[model samples]
Target chain A: MMDTEHLGTHISKQFNADLENLREEVLAMGGIVEEQITLALDAFTNNDSDIADKVIANEKMVNAKEMKIDEACTKVLAKRQPAAGDLRLIVTILKTITDLERMGDEAEKVARMAKAIANKEMAVANVKLHYGALLHLGNHVKKMLHDALDAFARMDVESAVNVAKLDNQADEEYNAISRQLITYMMEEPRRISEVLDFMWSARALERIGDHANNICEYVVYLVQGEDVRHKSWDEMQRLAKDE
Target chain B: MMDTEHLGTHISKQFNADLENLREEVLAMGGIVEEQITLALDAFTNNDSDIADKVIANEKMVNAKEMKIDEACTKVLAKRQPAAGDLRLIVTILKTITDLERMGDEAEKVARMAKAIANKEMAVANVKLHYGALLHLGNHVKKMLHDALDAFARMDVESAVNVAKLDNQADEEYNAISRQLITYMMEEPRRISEVLDFMWSARALERIGDHANNICEYVVYLVQGEDVRHKSWDEMQRLAKDE
Candidate 1:
């Protein structure tokens, strides 16, 4: 009986180690997802189909990584019967994979938009009003995604909350950009459809920011064991402030 | 030993029953979500705040139901260790909840837009092209969501594929509506912001259709255990055609 007990403990330790490795794998996948988004955006802004094609080619990697991570999660879930924190971690991996996969889809959309505009003459004249703002918003999104992943790695709720705050700034910038784009479209009716397509690309980037915010929410849940969703932005700010 | 064996069987049976109940609950939630979308469109078309208010109130119910379903899923997952088909069902519930919650958010957005336009004078020229196409698109969205949920509950993959096919029609209508709204904004620059706001409401409705398509995709997965996501519309159609 004592030998059996010792073997059981050893198996549990092995399982725990596998779970930690799975977590690292998921973070690696997240990093690739964020890079894909940034690359897809750059391809769009520069009108480079080669870069866009690269983004499309990389989606197979994303899909493959997602499946591998999912398999790891299910294996851990089935064999370990992880309770409490470990269970939550596995569940978060599963949820994050879905978000990451959708982000990949958004990136593909950006690439497709870029491909459509590849041969067209540059319409830089109308995009000037909000170029700085859009770039700022894009950088903010990159930071949010970066910091959120870092926070998840370190289990730092404070960093996660900070990432969530940046999402608001991104939102404001998106609104300003959209308003300016509408004005641009009105001024140049001939370019209406093309500009609208670009607006859709911007919207996709803004949505990626929202998904980053969602990842931060999951991080907060992981740390606090509480559901912070459905709360107002002001309330979330206050809570983060208290933290 | 006999007693322990009996207890195990009893637990398994109870767990299966709970899983079925959870699936039913999700379907019921889907029904309520679809209704909110339909009613919000009605409120927008007829300038009816009562229906808008009802949708807003129903959103609370949807939220509460989501929590209940989530709780049930957690309990089963923790205690039951469900495998194979049962495991797939639980994952489906989790994914479906996210879609349903998003649908609720879209409904709330539509209601808010309706309320904003409720007190205002209707458009001066009655925008014949905008409202006509939007009304038809809205009805199509309602039908698509209804059919998707039906396919989900019945595990009818063919029906789900059919519902998915309708998404293209909705997208076409959405594009037509957006062009009309843009034309209006161009004609009346002063009303640009308001027109843009109304356009977003229509956009949200279009997104609801997209989510319905996503649910149908999930149904296909449930039935065939295949991941058809990220495939081209033509490819998906081909697969369905072969069936």
Candidate 2:
């Protein structure tokens, strides 16, 4: 009977080890998703189709990793029947994989935008005015994505709340960029379609920032067991401010 | 041993019953969300704060139902290791809950906008322009939501595809509304902020329409085992268009 008990303990330990490894893999995939966003933004800034193509090519990797992570989570849930922290970790992994996959899709959108603009001549030719704001906005979003992942991994609610704050800034920047592009189109209506595409790309990045903020909210839930979503922005800031 | 087997079967049946009930609740919630959108639009057109207040109050009900449905779904998933059709039903319930919740939020936004404009004097005072477009757009969205839910509940892939096509028309109408509102604001700079708020509300509704389309895509996946999400609108039309 003692030997049987020891064998059960050994199996539980091995299962936990595997679960931990799965968590690490999920985080690693998150890092790749973040990098893809950054590279996709770089492609947008530089008008580099090659880099954009690379980002598109890497989508399969992200999707595969997402599937594998999801399967691993299900396996852990089914076989181990993890309780409390382990269960929360597995659930978080499943949710984070979804966020990562969505981020990958956003990167692909940026890549498609890059490809669309790569061969087209500048309709207005004010390259700095157009690309500079986009690059700035893209960089801010990429940073937000990275910080959100870090916060999730560390269970750092403060960092997660900070990501929420950064999203407002990103929104402001996006609005400003939209205003600038609108002005450009109003000045030269012929550039309307191209500028509209660029606006969508910027909107995609802003949406990515929003999703990062969503992940941070999940982190807060994981840490504090509270739902901070759907609250007033001011209220969320106050609740998470001291964190 | 026979008694134990009977107990197991009873538990499973009870869980399945709970799941079916939860799906019905989600559909009911979806119905309320659709109603809220229509009522909010009616308030906007009729300039009726009473209607707007009703919509706002109804949102509380929507929120409460969302929570109940969510808890039921979690309970079902936790206690029952559902497979095949049962698993798909649970997943659809979960996804549909999110769509319903978001729809509720969008309706609330429209209600808020109606309240904001209730006291204010319209610069254009074009009731026809203001109420007519919103009502038409709201009707389109309501149909989309209804059809999407019907398709989901029935596991009807063809109806799901049809709902996707309707979503494009809604998008076009939404874009036209945006342009009209922006043009109005540009003509009357004093009403710029208020008109922009209205435009944002419209955009939120349009986003809700997009989510409905996404829900339809999931329904298609559930029924046909196909990922039709990333396909082009034109290609989807060609493949699944109803004559």
Best by TM-score: 1
Give the local distance difference test score of model 2: 0.76
- List DockQ for all candidates: 0.38, 0.17
TM-score of chain A of 2: 0.91
Steric collisions counted per model: 0, 0
Tens digits of lDDT, candidate 1, B1-243: 122213666776777688778988998999899889888988888878888898888898888887778767766777665666676677777777878888898888898888777767766354534666777888888898899888888888788888878999999988888988777766676676667667878888888898888888877766776666656677666766766
TM-score of chain A of each: 0.90, 0.91
lDDT of 1 by residue, A99-192 (tens): 7777777778878887787767666566545546666677778787888788888888788888778888888888888878877776776666
Interface RMSD of 2: 5.4
- Could you give candidate 2's per-residue lDDT for residues A1-243 as a string of tens digits? 122213577888887797779868977998888889888988887788999999999998898887677657655665554555565566566666777787889889989988888868564366346788888888898889889989977888888888988999999999998777666656655555576668779888998898788788778867876656656577767777655
Off by over 4 Å in 1: A1-7, A237-243, B1-8, B122-128, B233-243
